[model samples]
Target chain A: MTTHNKIDPLGPGYEGVAGKELRFRDVFRDTLRAEMNRDQDVFLMGEDISGGFDRDTKEPLDAWGGPFAATKGLVQEFGPERIRDAPISEAGFVGAAVGAALTGLRPVVDLMYFDFVTVAYDQLLSNAAKSRYMFGGQTRVPMTLFARSGAGTGHAAQHSESFYSMLAHIPGLKVVVPSDPYSVKGLLAAAIRDDDPVFLVNDKKLINLTGFVPDEDYVIELGKGRYMQRGDDVTLVGMSYTSVVCEQAAVQLADAGINAEVIDMMSLSPFDEDILLESVQKTNNVVIVDEDTPRASMASEFAAVIADKAFDHLDAPVKRVTGPHSPVPYNKGLENAFMPQPEDVVGTVRNMLGRD
Target chain B: MEISKEKLEWMYTTMYRIRRFEETMLEQTFKGNSMGVTHPSDGQEAPPTGVCAHLTDKDWIGSTHRGHGHCIAKGLDTHAMMAEIMGRATGQCGGKGGSMHIADFSKGMLGANAIVGASIPLAVGAALTAKYKGIENESVGVSFFGDGASSQGVLHESMNLASVWKLPVIFACENNGYAEATPAWYSVSAEDIASRADGYGMPGVVVDGMDVFEVYEAAGEAIARARAGEGPTFLELKTYRYHGHFHADDPKKYRKPDEEEHYHERDALKNFEKRVTGQKLMSAKKLKSIRDSIEQEMLDAVEFALESPMPDVEALYSDVYVNYSNPIFGLR
Candidate 1:
C-alpha cells in the first residue's frame, strides 16, 4: 500500500464490452485454456490435476478435474504432457516450476489449497519470489500459481486459508484475489501473462457462484483495484469473498441511507492506492473487511494506508472488520463467526455513521 | 568415455579452473575483499567438470552452496564470478546475490542456491522444460548438491518426480564426506546416497570423485541416458573438500589431520597429472602450461574483482519485477 505506483485501474474498453454469464470455476479454467492455446510454452503442474490414470489403458483420468474442478477437461484438450499431474511434492514441483520459468517455459501450478503453501514455502520464497531480484534480472520467473482459499466449506482449519498479505508481503511476488467470475477471468488472465511470479487465490465459496463475464479476451492490470459500487458516505473495502460481503453490506446500508462505496481489491501487492485514497478522500469514512485474521491482515494494511496518507481527510478513525486472531474453527457457528460477515460490515458502518 | 585431445584439455582446464577459483576466492575472502561468507569448493572439482563437460549453454544446471566449481565448469566468466564474490557492480548478479547466489542464465547455470536441497527441483524443472518441449536431447539438467542436501526432502521428491515423468535430469550428489563439519556417515540415512535412487526407480552409480577420468566416464553415460529420454540418473561422487565449510570456519576443530592428509595424498589434480603424463596422453610440460595459464587467469580475476566499482544505490530498487509500477513502497 505504501507503493506510490499507480495504474489506470484498466477500466477502459469495457464500454459495451459483450459478455456471457459464467461460473467462477469455469472462467478460471477458460483463462488457463486460453493462455495455453495462446502460448505453446504454457503448461500445468499439480497433484491430481489429471487425477489418476486408468491402469489398463494408461490414459489419464481427469478424475478431480483440478482443485474444485477449476481446471476440468483441460488435460483432455491439452493432453497429460501439457496439463501435467505432479506428485504431492509442493516444494519439489514449485522449485521445478521456478526452474522451468527461468529456462524458457510458462508453468501454471495449481497448489490445491493455500494452507498447503507452507509445504512449498521455501521454493516460492527462496527461488520464485527472489530469483529475479537476487539474480539481477538475469531471469524472469513467468509462472502463475493459484489455489483454493477461504474457510466456508466445513473444510475446517488446514484446508482453508485466505492469507493474501502473506504472499503480498514478499517483494517480487504478485498477489491477486478475484471476487467473482468476471474478476477471476480478468485477474487470472493478467496473472498468467504477467512475467513475474503471481499467486491468484480462489475462494472455494466463489467457485460455484456465477457472474457476468465479457466474452472478449481481456486482462485486468496487475496492482489495480476496481470500484464495484460507487457511493458517498463510507468506503467498504474487501478482497476475494469479502468483496461479495461488502457488496451485500452496501445494499443493506443503502436501505438505511448509508451510501457505502465498495472496493474489490483484485490485486494485493502493488495494490491500487489511488482508488483507496480517492474513495477515502470522498467518503471521509472507511471500513475494511478481510477473512484473514485481524493482526497484520489486508484489512489492517488498508487501514494503515488511509491513516498514513489521508489522516486529515478521515472524518472518523478507519475501522477494520476482520476475522479474530485465531485458527479457523470447525463448528458451523464458530466458522461463520470467524470471518467478516455482511452483517458485521453493515453493523460497523451503522456504528461509524451513528445510525445505531 | 573416449577422450579426444580437445576434450581432455577441457577436462583438465575446467578442473584446474575450479580448483584455482575456489582457492583464490578463499584467499580473497581471508584478505577481506569478499563481502560475506564463501563456501570454497577447492577439492571438489571433478564432478562438475565431468558433468558440465557433457553440457552446453543449451543444457541447465542447479548448483549448491559450495558452487564455484559448478560455475567454472558451466563456463561462467571468471571475472564476473570473482566480482560477484567481492560484491561489485560488475558481478554476475550485480552484487545483489553475492557469494551464495551467483547465477548466469545465458550459461544455463540456474544458480548456486544458499539453501540446502533447494536447487534440486530447479534442475528437475529445467529437465521438465526440455521434456515438455520435446528437446531432451539438446537440453538436460544436472543438480550438483552436497551430502548435507542429500537428506533434504525435496531431493527425494525431485527424484520421484523425475523418475515418474522420465525427465532428463542427473542427480549429482557431491559426497565430500562432510555437511558443514558433520560427517555424511553420521547424517545420511543410507550407506550410499545413490542407493536411494533404487526406491525412485533409476540407475544409480557411485564414482571416485577425486579422479577426473572416472567422473567424466560416469557422468557421460548418465548424461547420455538422460538425453536418450531414459529418465534420471543418480551419481554419488565420493569426494572431499580441502577447506572448511566457510572462509572463517576451522576444520581442525572438528576434523583430524590424518583425514585431511589422506584426501590430499589422493589429490585429484596430482593423480590426474601423474596418470596423464605416465600414460603419455599429455606431457608434463603441457600440464604445467595449463596450470600456469590458470594461475594467471586467477590473478587476473582477482584484480578484476578488486578494481571493479561497487553497485550504485539505485540498484537497491531494480530487478524485483519486470514491470512493477512501484517496487519501492513509501508514503505518497
Candidate 2:
C-alpha cells in the first residue's frame, strides 16, 4: 500500500518529496497533528487520548497516549482543548461526536478497540451514518472514528475484532482499512477531510510495523485499492492486515514457481471492487483473504462480486482464506489459527491452482 | 420573566400554532394521508415553545419522537412539515423523513430522532461545536426528550459530558408520564427525573409544562446561564400528551379516564390563553384572532400536503452519502 514520495496524494505539481521509515503508531499521531494544524475545526475525542489530568492544575499528563500510544504527544502540541480526552462512556461520546460533526466541526473519536464499537453502535449507525439521509440531506456528519482491530494481538475476544463488515453493511457510513504506515497516513488524512462519516479500522497488528512513509501531505482517495504486486497466476485480495498477509503469500507463492497479484482493498464499505474484478479478470484465479469471522465477511463479499462479474474469466472457483466462525481466543496457538495467515492464503492459492 | 407585548404575542401565536398543528396532523393521519406513524405533541407544547422562544436560528435543539411541537417552535414551516408527514417530495426532508425525523439544519434543529434518548448527544455535540468555536454567547444546545427517555444511559452520559465540558447545553426532559403504554412511575426509578440532574452536577428545575410563562422563564434562565458559560442545566417539564404514542394507538387502552381529564383541564393552550387575557397582556379578541389565523394555517398546511407529489424512486438512493464513489446501490 506504500506508493512512495513520487506519488503525493495531494496530487500533481508537488513532487521532489523525501521518505522516511516510521511505525504505524507514529504515523497515526503525526497525521492527527498535521490535520489539526491544517484545519482549525479538526479536534479529537477519546478515552485516554490524553491519558490523565493533574489533580490540581488539570493539565493533561499523556500517560498512555491511548492504547498502543497511537495518539501520543498530540495533547501537548494541540493542547487539551483540541485533543480532548473523554470518559469511558462510548455511546455518550460517540453520540456527541456525531452531533459535533453535524454542528460544524471535524471530530475524530478514538473508539479504543474495534469490539467496543458495539457499545456505541446505535449512535454510529443511527445518527452519524443515517442523519444526512434521514434528515433528507439537511446535514452532513463529517466525523472520523478509529480503533485498533485484529486477533493476532493477545487482547482476547472482547478487545480484538475485525467486524468491519457490520459497518460496511451500513449504507451511509464509509469504512476504511489502512494496511501499514503509508496507508494510515494517506487514509487518515482523507478520512478526516471526508464530509461523510468515515470509520477507519486500524488493525492492532500493523500499529507497530514500520514501513515507507512519504514526507508529503497527501490523501489516498477512499474506495480505491492499489496493486502491491502484479501477477497473472492468481489474484490475492486483502484488506487491513490481510493485505500484509497477501503480500507475504505472494512472495512465498512466487518462490514456489507460482505468480500471484496482490490487491489491497483499502476501503471496505465503498470497496475497491474494480481492482479485485480487474485482477481476477486478468489472472483467472482469485483468493480473497480476511481476518474477520467467515460468515458474512468481506472475503465472502469480494468472492461474490468476483463470481458474479467475472465468472467467465475464472478458471477456478473463488476461494476465501478467512477467520473461522468463532471468537478469537487468548491462547497463542488458537489465536494464530483464528487469523488468516500468509501460509493459509498460500495453501488456498496452491489448491486453487492445482499445484499443491 | 418579564414579558414584552411583542414577545407575548409571538408566544401565544407559537403555542396556538403547535396546538392546531398537532390536531390537524392527527386528523390527516386518521384520514389516511400520513405515510407512517405520527407522534402528536399536543399537550407538551410549552416545553419547546418556551425554550425555543429564547433561542435564535443559531442555537441548536435535538428532538425526540414526539417532535411536532419542537419543530413548530424552531421555526420550521408547517407546509413542509405536513408534506413530510404525507411523505411528499416537497416536505422538509423531501419525504425521506416522516413526522419523527423532520429537520431544518438552517434552523439549527437537529433531526427528530425515532430511537428513545438517541438525540441527547447530538445536542451536546452542537454545544461542543459552539464552545469549540468560542461562540457560546451566540449559540447554545437544547435536548428535548420525554419521561420515557429519562432512564436511557445516553441522557445521563450527555448530561455529564455537557457539565464537565461546561458546554452550552440544556437537557429539557419532558416528563409526559408515559413511555408508550408504560407509565413513568413504573419505569422511572426517581421520584422526579430532574432530581437525577443533581447526580450529574447541574441545576435541575421542575417546571409546570401546563404553564407557558413558567416554562419560558425557567428556560430563559437556563439558556442564559449556558450562553454565559456557566454550564448545562437539566429541566424536567412536567407535561402530558393528548394522544397515544403513535397515530393509531389508543390511550384508553392504558390510561385511566381521570388522568386524561386532569391533563385536558389544565391544557397548555387553554392556560396560555387564560393567563394572557387575565393579566391584560393580551386581549381575548386578539387571542381569538390568533386562533382563527392558526385554524386557517392548518387548513392550508393540510391542503399543501395533500396536493404535494411523492418523491421519485431515485430519491431512495440519493442523499445516502455526500459523495459515494460507488454509483450503483444494488449488486453487480
Candidate 3:
C-alpha cells in the first residue's frame, strides 16, 4: 500500500508533454491503470500482485506490489477484487484466467517469470490457445499473459530464457515483445483490448530502462514492425531486448563507416514478414539478432522466411547473432557470455559485409 | 429445502435424460456410428443432475471427460451434444470438440476437459469473475471432477483459492470408484475424499451419489452458501460407473466380476424411481411417460446427429482466433 505523491511526467521517446523521464516499469503500471479505469471488465491476477499479504502481521498489508513492482499502487486504485493476489499456483490461476476470459471478463494474468510458463503450459497451450478452435469458434479467451524474460538479470536457468518462440509456435496465440517504455505502453494496451489470447513478454533487463512514453492511453497494432534506423548497407533485425543491442551495434557499424538499417521485430507470432522481405530486398545483406537460443528460434524462422522469399535478393548468406544452445548460466561472467551482446551483433554485421 | 412434486419430477426427468443420452451414445459407438472416443456416464447421473438442478444459465459448471451427464444437467441441448459426439457441424462445438471437449458457453457449460483436474481451476476463475462483479448477481461456478482428479495439485490450489477469496464455487467430486483403470481405493489414500477439503479451510461433505435426493439436498446447501458469499464447499459424491472408462475399454480387465452388479443394485435412476413412487411425489404412469419422452428425445438426437453434415474444409481454420492470420510457417 505504498503511494507516490509526486506526479511523474512523460519520458523522452515520444513527442508529448514535457515531464520527468518514465522508466519501463512506471509506463507499464500507468498503462495498466489507464486500461483498468477505461474498461470495468479488465482486472489483474498474479502472485503478490496486490501486495496485500504482510509477512509480519500474517495479514494483508497494502504493499508488496508484485515481485517486480509492475503492479504497484494498483490494489489501492482498483481494490482487491480487481487487483487479486493469487497463491503461488501458476497452473491454477492461469487456467482460471482462461476460464474467466471465456466467460465474460478481460483478465490480465502474470506468469511472474517467462520460464514459469512451463508449469502452466497445458492451460496456455491446450485450454487458452486451443479452446476457441476446439470449441468451433463458440468462445474467445480475451486475456493477456504477462511475464518478464531475458538472461541478463542473472535469475539463473529456471528464471532466465526468452521462450516467446515456443508460444509463437502455437497457432492461436499472439506474442508481443516490446523493447522499451513507449512500445511497452502501446503494445500492452493493444494486448489488453485484443479478443484473443495475447502473450506480452517484457524483458527483465529493460525494467529499469527509461524511454519516452505518452501520458494518455494508446495502442500499437500487433504484428507490425518499426524501423529504429534505416540504411541500404545491410538490415539488422532485432527483437525485444536485442533491439537495444542492435541500436548499439548500428552505432558501432556507423563508426566504422558502415551504414546499417535497424529493424525492431516487436511482435513475433503475427510477425511482419512483408517488412522483413522488403528490407532484405533493399539491403541484400541481413543479420538477425535474437536473445533466445539459436536452435528453432524466431531468428531461424525469419532466416527461413528470408531464404524462401528473398533468396535472389541476397548479397551474402544471412547471419544470426543469438544466445548459444546452452542453459543460461548463474554466474554473471558466464551469463554475460551466454547472452548476445552489441559486440556480437556488430561483428556479425561487419563479417556479413566482408569487412574486417 | 422441501422437495416439491414438480422439482422431483424434473430431477427424475433430468437423470433419465442423462442416462438415455449416455446409453444411446454407448450403443452408437459400439455400432461404429459415432466418431472419436466416448466416456459414458451410464450409471452416474444423479450427481450432475442433482448438482446442476440448483444452477442456472447465469451460473457456470466445468465438466470432466465423462461429461455428457453434466452437459445435459447443465441445460445443453441434447441434439447439439449428440451432433458434437458424432462430429457434425450442427453440434454445440461445431464438430471440433468431439466427445472429450464438448462445451456450450451459451448455457454456462464451460466444456468438458480431457485432462483430469483441469476444469477445477476454470470453475474457480468463473467464480472469481462472479465475485469480482459483486454478490448481487448471486452467480456460482460449479466444477465436476472424478476421484482421480483428487490427486491433482490444481484441485488443492483451486480449493485454497476459492476458500481464501470466498468466491462462489462448488467443488463437486464425483468419486465413481475409479480413476480410469485404477481403483480409487488404490489411488486416493484418504478414506473419504471429502475429508481432503478440511486442509483447504472449507466444509467437506460426502453424499450418497446413488440417491438423487441426497445429492440434491447437499448440492442445494452448498450452492446456497456460495450464493450467500460464504465461499466454496467440497461435496464428495460416493458413486460408481457401470461401464468401462470409455466405450472401447473393457472393465473386466480391471474390476471385480460382480462390481458392476453390486453398484447397479442401488443405481441412481432405480433408487430415484423407487423413492419418488414410494413418496407419491410422482406416479408410476407419470414416471413412465417421462422416461418414454426422454427415450424418444435421445432417439431424435441420434438421428439428427447422423443426418447432420460434417464441417466444411474452410471451417478447418475458423475459430482459432477472433482475428489475425496464423503465422506459424507450414501450418497454413
Candidate 4:
C-alpha cells in the first residue's frame, strides 16, 4: 500500500534500448550499483562478490567475486556488511535472504548456478514464495534470487538448466529472463525494487553480448512481454537464453521469405499470455523455442494454449523446438546437438511451410 | 516453582485451547467438515505453550505441518485460524493457505510450512535479519519441526549458518517419535537429533516435551543465548502426538492400541494440570470453568463456520498476486 513518487531505475526513461549497444555484463553491474546507490534497504548476499573492489592497496579486486561474476565490485561501494560472501551453502543464504526480506531489507541473493536452486528449494518455494500469503499478507518478501542459466560452458548436466518453467508453475513467484543487456539492466533494477520475490534469470551467453543502455535508472514492469521484432508470417515465443536462438531463427526465416514476429517473455509466472495470443492470432503460426525439455516445457504449455485458443487461425500445427528429455551431456557435440539451435528453428519453419 | 499462579493458569488455558481445538477438528474430520488434511497438535501443546512462554512478540517462530500449537502459542486468533481451516474469506491467509500453512507475520510467527525442515532456513534468515539490523537482544527466531525434519539437509545447513554468524535462533526439534507413519528410528539415522547439532558447533539439549517446565527451561537458555549473541541453540523436545498423523489419517494401522494410553500417562495436559493443582495455584472449579469457556469458544467457531457461506465463486482468483489484475486461471 506504500507508493514512492520517485522514478524507478527501469522506468520509461530507458525503454527500447538495445543489448548490442551496452554489454550485458556492464548492464548488470550498472543496475546493481544504481539500485544500491538509490535504496539503502537494498543489499547483496552471495559467494565472494568482492571481485573488482580496491582494497587498502592500489590494486583493484573484484568486490563480490563469485562464479557468475555478476556481483563483482559490490563490496567496495557498499562495504562487507551489505555485500556478504556466504559459505558453500545455498540453503542458508537463500533462507537468510527470505528472513531479511521479511524484516524490511531488500536482499538480492545470487545462486551462481541455476541448478543449485534445488538445494534451496525449501527456502525458495516454501518459505519465500508462501511467506506473504501464508502470513495473510502481513509481510512483504521483496527479495531477488539471481542466477546464471543455460548450457554454453561445459559445466555439464548439473550446472546448466532452463528451469524457469518449473519456477513459473509455482504461484507467488515472479520469474524474469532478460535476454539482452538492456533488459538485464532494467529487469535487475525492477527485481531489486519489486515488493515481491522475483527470480531474475541471466543467461551466460548473453552476459558478454553488448547493447545500448541509458545512464539513468529505469524499470521494465514484470509480466509485460517485449516484442523484440514485429512480423506477420509467424509468432515466435522465446524465454530465457533461448530468445537469442529465436532471434537468429527469425532472421533465417526472414531470408527464406517468412516474416516471424518474436516475443520475448520477460516474466514467466505472471506471464504475458495476452501479447502471446495477440501475436499468434496476427501471424496465424506459432513456434515456441525453449532450451528446457519439451515435456511440460514452457513451449508445450504455450503451444497448448495457442492450439486451444487460436486453432482456427493456424496455418499449420504449432511447432516446439526444445532440448530432448534427457540429462544435459558433458560432451560438447552431444550438448550442442541436444540443445535447440537456429538450424532446428529453420528446419521446423521449412517443414511447416512445405506442409502449407 | 518460580512460576506464578496466573502464568500457570494462562499456560494451562492455552494448552486447553489447543487440545479442544484439535478434538473439535478431529470430530469434524470424521464428519467430513474439513478439506485438505490436518496434522493435529492434540498432545504436544506444552512444547509450543511452554517454549512460547519465554518468547515475546519480537521473537520469531517457524513451525511444522502440525503447527496449530505453535500458532496459538504465538498469539494467533483462534477464530481466524478456524475460518482459514473452513476456507473462509475472513481467514488469516484470506483462505488461500489453510491448516498446515496458517501464519500471522505481525506476531512474528513467520509461518508453518508443510515441507519438512523448510522453516529452518527461514528462521535462520529472520534471525540473520535481526542481527543485520542490530535489533540483537530484542529479537530471536525459533524453528519448530518434528523428528522427521531433522533428516533434511537444509536443517543442518541452517544450523551451521546460524552458528557461524552467531545468529539469534533456536532450532526446536519436537521429536514426537514418528515422522508421519514411520517411527523416528526408521527415519532418523542419528542417535538423537540433538547430538547432530554438535557437528554445527552449537549447544544441543534434550528435554521432556510433555513437561512445560522442561521445554520452557530449555527454550529459555536457547533464547537467552541468542539474545546474548552466543549464536544458535538446538533443542530436541522428546514429545508425542496424541492423534494420527493428520485428521484424514488413521494411526490404527501404524500405532499399537495401548500406545495412546502409555503416552497419555505423560500427557502435557495432565502434567500441567497436576503441576498447577498440586501447588494449589488455582481452584479445580476455576480451572474447569476456563476449560468450559474454551470448549464453548471452539464450538462457537464451528457453528460460525457452518453457518457461514462458502466464499463467493467469483472470489476464487482474488489475492493471487498483488498490485496486478488477477487473471482468471479457471481454477475453482
The predictions' CA RMSDs to the true structure, in order, are 2.6, 2.4, 4.0, 4.1
Q: Ten-residue segment with the worst summed lDDT in candidate 1 chain A? A: A1-10
Model 3, A1-356: lDDT tens per residue? 11111112111234445445679999889889988998999999999886666668555555778879888888878877788888888998998898889888999998889998998988888889998888889899999999999998779999997977899988899999998887888888889999999999998989999976655546877887878888889999999999999888889999999988888877897888888998899999999999899889999999999999999999999999988989889999999998889899888887788798
For residue B102, what is the lDDT in candidate 3? 89
Q: Give residue A104's lDDT in candidate 3 (0 to 100).
A: 89
Q: List the residue pairs that clash in candidate 2.
A: none
Q: Give TM-scores for every candidate, taking all chains together and pairing residue i with residue i.
A: 0.97, 0.97, 0.95, 0.90
lDDT score for residue B190 of model 2: 90
lDDT of 3 by residue, B1-332 (tens): 68887888889889899888888998988888789899999788889988988888889999999999999898889999999988899998999999999898889989899988998989998998898788424679999998999999889888988888888999999999999899988999999999988998999999999888899999999999999888999999999888899998999999886878889999988888887789887899999999889988988999999999999977886777898843333534
Each model's lDDT: 0.89, 0.90, 0.87, 0.81
Residue B164 displacement in candidate 3 (angstroms)? 0.7
Which runs of model 2 end up more than 4 angstroms from their true locations? A1-17
Task: Write candidate 2's Cα lDDT for B1-332 as tens digits.
Answer: 68889888888889889988999998988889899999998888888989998999999999999998999999999999999999999999999999999999999999899999999999999999999999999999999998988888898899999989999999999999999999999999999899989988999999998888899999999999999999999999999998998889999999999999999999988888888788888999998898899999999999998998999999999989999888645754
Best model per DockQ: 2
Could you tell me which residue pairs clash in candidate 3? A1-A62, A1-A63, A11-A212, A12-A212, A13-A212, A51-A65
Q: Stretches of candidate 4 above 4 Å error? A: A1-20, A51-64, A132-139, A250-258, A354-356, B248-262, B324-326
Cα error, residue B278 of model 3, in Å, equals: 1.9
Per-residue C-alpha lDDT of model 2 across residues A128-154, encoded as one tens digit per residue: 999999889888989999998998768
iRMSD values, candidates in order: 0.8, 0.6, 1.1, 2.0
**Model 1, which residues run further than 4 Å from truth?**
A1-15, B329-332
Model 3: residues with Cα > 4 Å off, grouped in runs = A1-20, A52-60, B325-332
Worst 10 residues of 1 chain B by lDDT: B323-332
lDDT of 1 by residue, B1-332 (tens): 57998888898998898888988998898899999999998888888888888999999999988888899899999999999999999999999999899899899999999999999999999999999889999999999998999989999999999999999999999999999989988998899889989999998999999888899999999999999999999999999999999988999998999999999998888888888889899998998899999999999999999999999999998999998864474546
Looking only at chain B, model 1 earns a TM-score of 0.98
- Compare candidates 1 and 2 on DockQ and give the better one: 2
